[model samples]
Target: MEHQWVLLFQDAASVREILSHLIYLSFVLKDSPPLFVKLNVAIILEVLRYAQMHQLFPTFSLQTIVFFSLELVRVTTYEEALGQAINLQKSKLFCSRNTLDDLKNLIATTLGVRQVLGTCKYLGLPSMIGHSKHATFKFVKDRIWNKINSWSSRCLSQAGREVLIKSVLQSIPSYVMSIFLLPGSIINEIEKMLNFFWWGHNSANSRGLHWLSWERLSVPKVFGGMGVKGLKAFNMAMVGKHAWKLVSSLESLITRLLKAKYFPRSDYFGASIGHNPSYVWRSIWSAKDVIRRGFQWSIGTGEHIPVWDHPWISNVARILPSTHHHLEWPSITISDLLITPEKQWNMELINTFFDTVTARNIFNTRCFLW
Candidate 1:
């Protein structure tokens, strides 16, 4: 009953073959012969209608579909996949290969795809050159430094400098910070640049003493410090957002990709930092603690929740008293307490297994039953 859409073709002829196979599959699944014939005819008519509405010859549209389909496939071997890309005519490849001369020559002569190196930009974010966190974010520091060097602080008022720092300089690394946990050194460099812009002499070469610490300045308005954004906390919050998305948006493409690559056998809540993970993946994993502190499960059927461990009951201590360690059934779920037909908590069972105070709390706790 499971159906999969495959895109291994570059022309209308391939699409026709696929459609014919689908029609045959439908016929095999349907019991009534007349209905089977009608279903096949309907599918063909719908395909024709789709082609007409899009103003494309049915065969021509196959190339467009093929182009889009490439996004879903992970290209492991560029040379092998190059033939298919060439056949499409509308597609090209930008490759990052190792320094083996034989392999490079083979790719250049046979595949003809454009070769690139570590400097390639993806979605405007530069690729990390190596494992060094500071070097990875050096460009972000350079960018902000250049901007500060270009501006003459002498001509601008204190208020103008503050406005520029908040609006312009702080925003230079906002995009990169969202994905990478920037090094403390890089953050200090950025803060120094901002500090120099705010308190230093107007000349780019002149130095000035900071009247206040960067940490104090980063505090909120209600606090004693200026309300400036701290790079480290902002980076953590941004990465934490991705962790939140992985839990809440299970069907999202990012969630699916991460799940497949990092935690195929387990859920996001139970995922660990596996061996040799990418820097981006490592940064996302680092936010797991933040996500766990804020997460609470609402009681539904509660079949998947552990009674003692899960943070389900609101306004109560998360774990039971250590004195109750002798009690068995550590892995029991809330669903085990429910009466089968009536779907209500078994009071006698609860009383038998728990102390008077514990039993009373369990009986009084509100359950969402979702």
Candidate 2:
């Protein structure tokens, strides 16, 4: 049921709560009925109302395989409300290769659908991913190349080509990039196509002099180059935004769901790539460097930030305290450094464990409780 809802509002936050539950269905179901094409927020909300009234939802643990039997019934309830049924003939049921044949047949028969082997595409992105990531995301490169070749660059001025590249060509893979981190190779290939387009080469085989490297052109115009976005940097920024959300927007359903599985005990910055991590987790984790460099804990009750380990000090080259200043208070939190009740810095205790420079930095660190 994962759909690209265009002609809708620019942000998805308006319907995010209602759609949050639908994430499970993305893993369970590959295609939506024709009715989905015409759906607006109002129609979607109406459908959810019918679903709730009928008690179609079954409680299940997050990140676990959804019991298809229960979800299929929910789909039936949706069909009844929408007056359109799932086209089982055109639809596909993707399952793990390790799935038992008998169970697969039972579920497929129950839903009246065909079981497809290997990974299937849902809205042009792979529904299931494996180790061969580059192969899995080759569609991104192909899509960009196809679009670039189709456009006739012969008649357009350099300015017109710049607009086309900025507006249409770069946006082609944006949706996919937002979800998954495109491989470096694919990003390079896409940039190569864009570079050619910018310099008047319309086809892959055609040659044009690339006067400035893409990195230079991607710099801001103020820095003596075009303000074209660097694909690698842009992809990281897009994925890092999600990582930041997991920290800032704690109560969000997506945050809760991801936290439950990956970082149950630790925050996003501290979370590890656990054994057999999903592609989604890996993609998000890939931006950990970006998050770590930019992340600064806002000291609230000072409960979360570690005194020695975390980056809490602002406007410094190295936010964490230097290893030269060592202490055995591994269990200490930033709260311990505060004179509680007043919530002011404990200057005497700060000087006891830290060097002169380090002590000054600690005093300068802002505390919200104060």
Candidate 3:
């Protein structure tokens, strides 16, 4: 089994090398990885996981294997990693300054890797430095432009154009939008591309007068608009979905990473925007407000839910009204309102603290006590 595992690692390395080459070619060609290549890479990852689980390298810790295996996978997936690895191996480090002879010696050394400067495509998305939103989304814009330029608007009918815009053109940015809070400029550019495509402009460079504003067009068909999704809202909703997962999918890898890094002491909604957060974290954080706006607690043990602060009551303010200026409510849990022995809400206590209207509303509102 150990010998077979060794052979598997060797095979994985060869497969990784081939994948690295294919990834490089795809990057050079400015195209996404083929479906077959992605499937093979997934298989390699599963095999690596299995090998790790079985303690293939008994001499080394699983952490060590995982660290190196991850690097191998990174090199295979991203051309940038492969280039960086080759550069490191060749001692061709890119820095602000180097000694004259050192530079000469470095130049004289045989080039083993493609030295990527500034930004490069990684898994069909631009991997960039800093927060240059426009530059990062330039590839997406170019892709949309190329796709639009390929098709003739004059040939397609209005209905056909709408179908293509909704189904094909809008989907171009969906993957990127899901991860990044797209800049308004990029969103507008995408909308403009879609508009031009839908309206059937005289030529690729020309545009017909927009019949309705994109804001209006983005409304649901039932709401009297074109039923096209608003890009910004869609992006927010996608990020909010991640936030939902962070709360609900507690055992997920992403949830674990986020909890360790951002909200070690607190929950996801209460997490602070800590200093120097990653772009992904910042994007996720931006959608927290949206999540909070729509979120309502489904009472479990009620230990986590605060009666005064939390939005426990349906169609009511999160905080209850204070009786007097000096009257300070303690951090009251939802469990406090319940009769402990029977595990039921204390109706008399509820009526005592709240106003008649508020008390009536609270009684009417359904709550799960478990």
Candidate 4:
């Protein structure tokens, strides 16, 4: 960072924070040009240089130039300026060509008879921190490049996918249990259900309505129809809780619990805390106070809200335009969604809200169906 000196005394946080922010920006702002080319990059470099002048990071640690280089290019150990650095390339995790396969093989082969879990996982088992055989479901579809690269002819087969999914599900509980403080169990359960939802993507790729919003499938064997929620829709629904955690902070007990445990010192419902929040929180704010879309069976405009007695005013929620973006976070109404009457379906999911209004699982445990 050539401009580190300029930003040194100005304002800066930890290196990880800076790196995370850059990566995040690069992700969300993919449509824009490379962030480094922008003036802010030079400015930050100058600031980092200033920090080095003031002994901000240890002289032996990653210098500003190295910091930029690591993220931007392959930093070679041969550089005389690096004194006697480790050969990061050969010794690093990202350097592996078969990252996924290598990780999976490491987990399945090494931890096969371990009894508890496997190795492909991330951070789950207490013994998995450096065990190299952690049975974790790596987010393979995270980056755009990775996602595209993964779809090539060399990608794993359907049978392999099935095995991977099953293994991932099996390891979920163990991994989640390790994160005892967080609601990892619920998150894990959700992930499995998501796999079930997407297991038959091709069969239901085309919907009676919009192809993206999956038509509900009753869980097969138990329910008359095959039970499958659309993965995309389920993801959105799961993400919705985050928005609620933020916009309706006091309204959600789980968010409060997480905040109490993970961030007791941090504000639970502070609106001014973060510039960008996780998908869950952001989705909550987007859904707002509006009745759940899944609850409204159709474009039943003027259908009264039975609970609040607020008249149902249905229209296509203009969800995309800037006019509708505000409608997402701190949800204003169902109308806030960028929708048309045609896209809105008449599938009701809130028929029995009264049954579980205050109690969890009390409404759906027995013979009743919503």
Candidate 5:
């Protein structure tokens, strides 16, 4: 088993080297968009798939015939497709707590890796997030503390500390923040650490007078306060950037995938946090407010824009027109009001359905057919 594992690792390294060369050659040879790049990568990946399938054919076939024979009629393309081979020495297999011991053993032996309980770190963040979001994300707080502790507050002037705090301390959890909404407790604790460090206190035990609140510090320098980012707001903005992408890039693959899974019936703006949502989905959903506040739908086809639900009209004080009076009218799209082919708004229908103010606003807004 050990000899076979070593051979497998060597083979994996050779395959990686081949892939790197291929990728470099592809980039040098083809000047194309991201979609074409992905297609090129897919073609390269087929090499790995075949290599892995060749190596695992006998064992996989036996396993399929024995263990999963009833569960799955045949192995899926996804199962056969190439992925990064696990390093038996460094990699650990994580399974549900309730997973049977026999199944765990089978997986470990098959994969040549050890089984681990609880959770483990992957690329500085938890590979799996269990309940207790605070506990799961507590590492971010610890990381901030460690970085702050390493610095000497007494040696540096307030100016120096400010730069360090902004550049280093605040940026420690940015990658994590971009993906996950840090628990309020973790954010508060991290802010407290930053507050202490900024006020010339070396440690939590040291006392320093806090002349201004962290909020004031977080305010823009143009607003007569130091330009330090508020973690909570910054996190929201970072995650909201991705949410904004979903709104803007309707044809993107990720947008399509998320739409299919989370909000097949409605658009992204109207998506709900459906049952058993993923942490990624929840984090993105949390920032919907950030996107909503700034997002005004530009008139395109208007087929997707809901007249009652969407914020299409910027001329009015409220982006979304008041709907209390028109509750009786069925839900309608902006396109529904248009006389098609000519793509002109049907003033008769608009005047019949909407109040004078709304009808006027609809007419005032321009819609381009092209």
Candidate 6:
């Protein structure tokens, strides 16, 4: 088994083939690892529970809201020995007879009371805003909200907040990626995904309860917001911890120490040896692509934070002209003089000529406008 598993994905073609079969391969991989099998069974069972819950009781389907809660438990449980038996038992309790009432009762016990008073869990005010359940964006007005006297506000239980963050971080990527994968104007229509079906937060006069209404906070800072991050951003923020491994990786004293003490190459899941990396390392790497997409922030030249008009990128006023630009600035191309100076001088004419020249020369772009 070791030898076969080792040889399974030895080449580029194999990696591509495996990626193509990622969904199927995931199912196949459940058997080999003894540790995760029990809990994975739990996850599969919960996934089914939620799916059925959604189908049967759309009105009461807070199931997907808490689904992330289960996933959070799975990833962080660390030791199968601690989680498997209890969680597995929880599944049986849920499916004892496969009736909605029994499932609801089981969920009530296993999930412990916080059954989300409003519509769905994700649709909750804080959750909708991409905040941890702990976050509460209250109206600066509203007699009820205004009644709270101090910024030194009481907060929700830290436990609930953490679970909220974990759930949102894990679930948002699939939505963001699926949106980007669509073609043409379909991407533009992605705003429909943000349409509000409902919004409410706990009415308790606690700090966390402040995030009740959608009116006070949601959009973004530029759109006049406190710039409270969304789930998509938080998800990347969480995934970024792993991505730092690949980016900050080095063969140094610190890395060696980290490897030896906390995550050894041998014992650690993600450590790379020759070709194969450890599982911990691989998970971080897998998350990199998602992080890359989630982490859209970047620093550009001239310390200019780009506006929507130039949000894609902004040019920096270079203190030191890069060698390639100062030295090799494609000086005076033959076509530069081919077009009449009058023609070249016209912005419209120049744009057409530049496009043709760039396309013909295989430059992909021609932004030179001296």
lDDT of 2 by residue, 285-361 (tens): 98988888877778888876687777787666647775543456776888888888877898998888788887887
lDDT of model number 3: 0.67
Model 4, which residues run further than 4 Å from truth? Answer: 1-223, 246-281, 289-370
TM-score result, candidate 1 = 0.68
Q: Candidate 3, 303: how far from true, in Å?
A: 1.7
Which runs of model 5 end up more than 4 angstroms from their true locations? 1-91, 323-328, 340-343
Tell me the TM-score of model 4: 0.23
The local distance difference test score of model 6 is 0.35
Q: Give the TM-score of candidate 3.
A: 0.67
Candidate 3 lDDT by residue in tens digits, 68-165:
44444445556543453333453332333332333223223322333434566566655554568788777787888898888988899988887888
User: What's the true lDDT of residue 65 in model 6?
Assistant: 26
Worst lDDT run of 10 residues, candidate 1, spans 68-77
lDDT of 4 at 58: 51
Pitting candidate 4 against candidate 5, the one with the higher TM-score is 5
lDDT for model 5 comes to: 0.74
- Cα TM-score per model: 0.68, 0.74, 0.67, 0.23, 0.75, 0.22
lDDT of 2: 0.74
Top-TM-score candidate index: 5
Once model 3 is optimally superposed onto the true structure by TM-score, how far is the C-alpha of residue 266 displaced, in angstroms?
Answer: 1.7
- lDDT at position 66, candidate 5: 24
Ranking by TM-score: 5, 2, 1, 3, 4, 6
Name model 2 segments beyond 4 Å from true. 1-91, 100-102, 323-327
Predictions: Cα RMSD each? 10.9, 13.1, 13.8, 20.2, 11.2, 19.3
- Candidate 3 off by > 4 Å: 1-115, 202-204, 315-327
Candidate 1 regions exceeding 4 Å error are: 1-99, 201-205, 317-327, 339-364
lDDT of 4: 0.36
